[model samples]
Target: MRPDDLHRYITERMRMSHVYQPVMLRELLKSDGEATVEQIAKALLSHDRSQVEYYEIRTKNMVGKVLTNNGVAAPVKDGNRIVGYRLTGFGDVDAEVRDRLIAECEEKIADYIERRGGNIWQHRFNAKGYVPGSVRYAVFKRAKYRCELCGASAEDVALHVDHIIPRNRGGQDDLSNFQALCITCNTNKRDQDDADFRGVADSYGHREAGCIFCEVPADRVIAENELCYAIRDGFPVTPLHTLVIPKRHVSDYFDLFQPELNAIRRMLDELRSSIQDEEPNVSGFNVGVNAGASAGQTIFHCHLHLIPRRDGDVPNPRGGVRGVIPAKQSY
Candidate 1:
């Protein structure tokens, strides 16, 4: 195409879902109509405000606080946000002295990188080096484009495909091994991969022969995590009713562990998303747990009911879970 054709296409015919097309074109133009994929990607990364926001949080909460407390530097705040840092006594230095100081900083960075080697970036890159884009999309989809760790939406922050178990600790590159985590949660969890979870793993093995949920067949399980499995209710109150049960035979909901609770919540969210996709009319859900005999618990094993609700499913759906009592359902 000639210059006029290119100009016409850019100004008139360019349809943009994001800023990517123009950014890539600008990069190519800057590089004399050619640029490596890496160069273009780096150029794109420069425009990602979320990444800068992620580092801003790190500066304010972690490194900046440390420096400020040590009397080495202070935070430059733009309202409540830490926009940058100002070094102590640095403003007093001339251009030459500042250059020497910058060189000293560079030397320190180089020495640290040399000493640590690739281990410095071990938190970001695992044994496999990178997760396939398809696998990442699947993980993100399963998590409903929200961080599984902190429940942050993808629009609110940058999400990462993180290993539930770190690769250094023998985590696999399987679909089931990956989870969607926001940048903040991922960074907070990075160095804490060494936390011992052997006892938690062992707890999932606790089961009683008589408990129906404890012995739920593999065939019945629709979705599961390490601590919980979800199955379609045998006698459903609604069409897409689900039972999210803990692996361990814990009779009381109060007796369930935190990890087990997290697993159950994740399974519930996954099932809800599936139901919504499969049944477009699904407007809401009813989550219930019958604790003891008085609360109408039939099985000894703890199981949560996830019942999908639709418009006009009931004559009047004013008080949802309160409908269990029937009398107080109206008010």
Candidate 2:
């Protein structure tokens, strides 16, 4: 379009969902009517004050704390807001010395980036790499544009779509496997919680060659996720009874990790819905786990029973699982 048309559209007719249209156009205009996606993205990022606020918090709480503790620099705060930082001894030094120190700092940053390469940003990109914009929008929408972990509004803090079970720990890319967290909460969870997922990913592959659950045939798996699977019980306690099992060979439920529990829970909910759909008479479910042989756990490998309960399945079902102990079934 001509300049008059473009200007008219921008001034009068441009309907905006966000600042993106103007920002992208500005970038393209600055580059002679052409700009890379990266350039547009960087320009858009400059308008994101939430990300800037996140880094400001990091500067004040982490880097500033360290520098101040070591007597190297201090924060320049406007009331409670930290606007910038000042080097401790730089003001007293000669101009040449100050320039030399600044150069040294630049050299340190360059050397670290050269040594670490892109690994320095691994935490941001994570093992799953870039999440598509649509998927990120879905996650944020699911969270109602709030942090799932801390309930921080998207307007107040930068929110991230995080894996409920980290991909490095064998977490999958299922919609059920993601959560929304604000920048502050996400950083604390990843850094301060000792997120040492080094061997956890590989550990999900552990299996005993002879274990029934571990060696369960592919045909038997009715449903599966990254860390667990479900199958029809060979010996059904109820018509549509099922077994939710961890892929890893662990002795019992007590040995399962948080991610394993999450996977199992997802499988249980899915199977429950499927069973109810298939069997209209199914009134409820009995979820049980026998942890040891003494507790009637003969399989050894960790598995949970998802028994579909129908009305009148038994003469006295009021006691439910209390039937585990015959005498205690009454109350």
lDDT of each: 0.78, 0.79
Score every model by TM-score. Answer: 0.65, 0.64
* lDDT tens digits by residue: candidate 2, 9-127: 89999999889999998898899998999999999999988777667777877889899999999888899888898988665778898799789999999999999999887755645
Ten-residue stretch with the least lDDT total in model 2? 322-331
> Which sections of candidate 2 miss by over 4 Å?
1-8, 26-39, 57-66, 75-84, 92-128, 132-148, 153-156, 163-179, 199-221, 233-238, 248-256, 272-331
What TM-score quantifies how close candidate 1 is to the native fold?
A: 0.65
Q: Per-residue error at 249 for model 2, in Å? A: 5.9
Instruction: Return the clash pairs for model 2, or none.
Output: none
What lDDT is obtained when candidate 1 is compared to the true structure? 0.78
Instruction: State, as a TM-score between 0 and 1, how close model 2 is to the true structure.
Output: 0.64
Model 2 residue 202 CA deviation (Å) reads 5.8
